[model samples]
Target: MIQDMGLELIRIMGPFDANLLGRLLLTLVLSGLVGLERSGHERASGFRPHILVGIGACLVTMAGAYGFAELSSERDALRVASYVVSGIGFMGAGAILRHGTTVRGLTTAATLWGCAGIGITVAVGLGWLAIAGTLLFLFTLTVLEWFERRLNFGGPISRLRIHLRDDSRSVGKALDALVRLGVPVKRATVLPGAGTSALLDVELARTLSAEQAPLLARQLLTLKKYVVQVETAITPLDEPTTMDESDEVQKDDTIVPLNLKDATLLRDLNDPDEAVPGSQTERSR
Candidate 1:
């Protein structure tokens, strides 16, 4: 009787005997592989979430294929599979984000959607196709990225935000510095800020190289009187080290005289009625 019971247990644990469990495990391995790639990139939806999505999609597909075997003539096996496809969109939508003119997380969303497809494929017993699809997915993420970088293909553009004194002279000086450094300005906007400062938003052109980006940032810092802060998406080569506190105070005192001179010149230009000093001397002669 014990020998017969062992034989029965073997039958219960056979591949065909437990097909649902096999499908679920296949889904986990395939999705987990894709998730590992995403996790390496530090995405929002990493390993665990991708695994769950894969397993859930696999379960749904398996249930539709087997659970309704009795009603196979009356019901369509693909009904539940169709629902999984549509329902995965809601999850994909959560991964996308939009900031100003830039949109992020698109690739992550597509990856999640692909994971669901892989799960469905595995559930239908097309294991070989699912594996091939996953290998292609990884190639797109890894190899394609390397190719893009090598060919100088522009992906996401970088943004630079500058806070500076609220003066037209300051704006002109800042623009001049960026232009001189060969940094192409795609779009520039000036927004009013608190106190006497203004915010400048600049989108850079694609031609800017990573090496040149930090140099441009350092050049902007030299305009200490006009530029209060410079923020960029690119990481700086070194910490933003500024001059000594005492030196900064001394520079501030020295800058006041030049500012007064500029203010006088601006006032003279605006008020045409004010006689120019050289012109008055010439009239007396």
Candidate 2:
């Protein structure tokens, strides 16, 4: 072997070698950030699930690239990676939940699916691209919500705590009523009750007309067949705490954001929170 030092160096640097461990570690950090954002929002799937999806995709890609390298002259790593993309659809679907016309957890599912892509990028040795993608994901999750609120681009959001009888048609009837009022539901959560009742929380970007909420409460009350208690609150788009909603949600000690003070309408329709002067309020029963 008569090889010049420069030529030998070129051969060592060029043969499509991937730093497997380094890529995996980079992917781990990237995926963790995405998961952390989702967890902050109390998503159904977060942290561990995203990390698993990313690491798994990375491993699959690496296996495709190297597993068949010695066994055959032709190798197609991208084909293996394609399966990961398509197969991840099923996992993403698990994160979505539907209740009546209101759907929740779609954003969570989307992020999980995104993490899979990040993993593949890292495995392909594009660490920089993967890092960029994770940053974008975080920005969308954290900043976009604030941006939407700041611009007032979306309508105000409100939460309705509806109590219904145990009968199955209860939810359907309530949804029908809301639709008649031209209200579009964004999210609905139902919790089983102790006796012949269940609790449903309706929230969203759907705009409510003047006196519409009070009208809704009264109209739903007419459905004595199933409707029980209906309480609506104007939910504020406050900055989420580092902890999840299960923990105490703390706001800045300085002053209550006007929207947060609006939430008091749910409890005290007679007297608005004195702390927040001129705070807007919506009423429901």
Candidate 3:
């Protein structure tokens, strides 16, 4: 009975059976390796999703090549493989995002598409080719990233949008503050703001790191009586919004009252104990 069972096990685990299992395993490993790298960088799509995509593609390709082996020669065995290619394109498109003029997640999308191809290659019995492709992908993502940083190639750029009190002197104060912070301004534009505020659009020549950005914003806020609000992002500036001449006339009238109120508030806060024009305190002083 033991000898008979051994023979049956060998029959079931033959070369054909082993090859199918090997292809599936290889697809999982190669795709998982790519996903691991992406996960380390905290990308949108990481290990498990990539592994699933790869394994699914591999299964689809295997089904195309072997599941229909008994079909007539007139039937197309490779039709399913073609569908896999087309379907994966939509997945790639979903990974991309656009912000104003800048687009992100492009590399992640390309990596996902490559993972699918690796799976298909393994399923088609091109195991060696799949291995080589995975290695190349890792090299581009890791070694090439190091190279780019060393050479300072394509460093990140940022945009700063600032809203300030609409006084003419505020613009000069804001500019002086940025200069003291050592941020090189590539472009600066002033726009009309609501009531007694003016918008300033600034593009920096050098990129600021995540840690440095908050520090810079804090410094700008302390420019004392000049800055109202500050916003920053790792994206390029778009075209400035245009204002009408008639709108400027209305704004001037509305802004004067608001400015007077703000100035009075600042004065009282700065010198709370000082007497006003006709107070009893003023008469005593």
Model 1 pairs in collision: none
Residue 202 lDDT in candidate 1: 75
Cα lDDT, all candidates = 0.70, 0.72, 0.72
Selected candidate, larger lDDT, 1 vs 2: 2
The list of candidate 3 runs beyond 4 A from truth reads 1-16, 74-78, 154-285
Would you estimate the TM-scores of all the predictions? Answer: 0.57, 0.68, 0.53
lDDT of 3: 0.72
- Which 10 residues in a row give candidate 2 its minimum summed lDDT? 239-248
**Model 3 over residues 26-138: C-alpha lDDT tens digits?**
99999999999999977778898789989999999887787664565543436776888889889989988764333657888988999989988999899999999999999
Highest TM-score: which candidate? Answer: 2
Arranged by TM-score with the best first, the candidates are 2, 1, 3
- For TM-score, candidate 1 versus 2, the one ahead is 2
True-structure RMSD for candidate 1: 13.2
The full ranking of all candidates by lDDT, starting with the best, is 3, 2, 1
User: 1 or 3, which is superior by TM-score?
Assistant: 1
RMSD in angstroms, all models? 13.2, 14.8, 14.6
Off by over 4 Å in 2: 1-18, 73-75, 149-154, 165-169, 192-197, 234-285
TM-score of model 3 vs. true structure: 0.53
